[model samples]
Each structure stands twice: as C-alpha cells, then as structure tokens.
Target: MNDGTQVHLRLVRPDDKKLLEQGLARMSPESRYFRFFSAKDRLTHAELAYLTELDGENHLAIGAARYLEDGTELGLGIARFIRLRERPEVAEAAITVIDEAQGLGLGKLLLTMLVLAARERGITRFQCDFLARNKGMHTLIERIADDVRYGHESGVMQAEFALEGPEGLYRALAGVARKEGHVRPGSGLPKLETTNDS
Candidate 1:
C-alpha cells in the first residue's frame, strides 16, 4: 500500500491514474454516494478522466491533500471550471470531496485554490449548480459566498461567489448578485436561471 498521507497540492498528472483510483476507493460509500449520487465503489474510467481533466475551456482541478511530512495522501477535493463560450468573461464552479475530509475545511481550501486559479486564468466569478436536496452545498455557499439563489421550478439552486479582493467584499458582491439574479452583475456574474448562462 502507498500509505499516502503527506501530500502537496498540485495539478493531476496523467500518470496518477492509479493514485486517483486508490483515493476514490478509499472514500466511504456514503461520501461516494453524495459526491457522485451513486453507491458504486469506483469511478468509471471516463468519469475519472472527466473529473481530472484540466482544459482551459472545460477543466477539472483536483487538490490532493496529504500529510506534509511523509507525502501520504489524506484526501482529494475537486473543483471544476467551465467557461461560457458565448460570453467569454463568465465561468462556473463545481466541486466534490471525499467523505472523511469533508468537514476539515478542505472544501474551502479546494474552493479557494481553484477559484484563485480561475482568477489567474481571468475568470472573475465562480458559480455553482447543485441538487437543491444537498443542504451541505447550501451551507457551504451561504457561509463563504455572498448569498444564494434558489430555483423552485427545477430544484436547482445556483450560488454565486466572487473571486476577487477581500473575502468580505466577495460576499457583499455576492449579496448583490443575489439581488441582481434578475439582472446582470456589472462586471461578470451572469443571470442565474438562464440555460444560456451555464
């Protein structure tokens, strides 16, 4: 066994296929169920590829958390960014975490790291689309983001959090997005309900 504990956050390499599989296998069934909405014990090869892919337009960024000393793998957290082709200034964020690591603030860490990377790539806002049934996502969004918008029509709630300046300002700007869900955010955040938006 690799006994992965200490790890560095880095881009997933194509060579890390086995490591990725091992990490996913280590997740509790419940975590896997929530993260993937399935009870299956493993990720399909295609799914794994999609989860780790890092294309500029449609990319997957995984932050592998580990114990720093021994390079042992502790857990893996994922952040995915999708660019809006029609409106190049916009993008979206999707995330998932392994069960054992959910409450350890790794979600925030993964989100921060990914959002920063998105900013580096010129993405100003990070938005989410998750099952309304997932309260965890709602809590996560409400805590770190400005505010959340709930869509009653399809059970889809999308949260918008700015990735700029101070975290407080981000939240406040997010608050504006909450109100402006009916309007376009001055800089970049798109309307929440449009399928054309993303």
Candidate 2:
C-alpha cells in the first residue's frame, strides 16, 4: 500500500468497460465475494452495461486510477451510489478495491469522492451491505460515517448513514463539477470522457 504511488480519481465512462473488466480480472476470489457476496469472477453483459452507463443524477460512480509512467492506466478501485426509485434522497452504495490497493487509502478516497458527488446530487443518505465477518468493512464504516446504524440478518450486515457528520472530510477539495454530460476538472484524471445518458 505504501509504494508512494499517486492515484487519480475519475468518473467512469462507457468507454472504460475494458478497464473495468481488466480490474475485475485482477481481483481475488475473496475480494470478489467481499464485494458481490458471491464468487462471481466476471461481470455479466448486463452488469457491465449497468456499471458503465451512469446517469449521474441517480447513479454516480467514481474510479481510482493509477497512471503508470508508460501511459497505461490501472484501475485500483471504484465506489458508486445508486439512488432508490422510491426514495431518491437515499442511495445504495458499494465499493471494491483490488488486492494490491486494499489498505492504501484508495477506498477512503473513492468513498469521499462518492460523498461529494452524492451531496451535489441532493442525495443525503447511503446504505450498504457486507458480510457479517468483514472486519475491514466495519472499520471503514466506523472511520468515515459518524451516525451509522447497523443491523444484522441472515449473517449479513447492513449499514446506513446520514452522510453529513464526521466533521473533518476532504474540506480542502475544491470539488468535482458535472457539466454538459462530462465531469470537469479536479477529478484527478485529466483525460476524462463523457457518456451519452440522454
């Protein structure tokens, strides 16, 4: 985690489907299970379509990419929130980091980006589910979210958050801008692409 590598945060694009699949291929079985709750290795066509084509208003995603010196981009992790149809102010959240990027603060960075993006879209709450025995997930939830409520059912843990507390966040970040179907500067990635969501 401490390779002193710099990771750039960027919005996911429909064109980045190959990148997403490659990243998924690098994940371990345990990592896949932790994220999907299943041993699913590859994303289905529908799932890939769903993940890349985001509306930004209801479904938002941000990815962490490490730009290599050779100009290749390696996706380290991704975090996203999908707003509920019946409750637009609340969204279901999920995050996954590759084995190499697990504890290097990529997850936190991506989550903070999601928070900012969700805040801009009028989403005030987020909910996520994880395995009951995932201590890393518990620690992450405890670290960023202050008013988290947890419930357990059928050996799975569901955590909900109001998304406004834990005072000191990326207060210094000037923030990301979404305009004209494209993500503006300050997203860490300079070559961000746009999606045709309309």
Among the numbered candidates, top TM-score falls to 2
Best by lDDT: 2
TM-scores of all candidate predictions against the true structure: 0.67, 0.85
The runs of at least 3 residues in candidate 2 whose Cα sits more than 4 Å from the true structure, single-residue gaps closed, are 166-168, 173-198
- For model 1, residues 1-198, the per-residue Cα lDDT tens digits are 023233334555455567668777878876665566557777778877766655644564645455535855454665567877775556777767777666766566456556655666677777687767777777776776664445543666667666656745434433432343312333122321123433
lDDT of 2 by residue, 72-165 (tens): 8899999999999999899999998899988876677667767767877788999989999877788888877887999999989999998795
Please give the CA lDDT of all the candidate structures. 0.58, 0.77
- Model 2 earns a TM-score of 0.85
**What's the number of clashes in each of the models?**
9, 0
lDDT of 2 at 50: 96
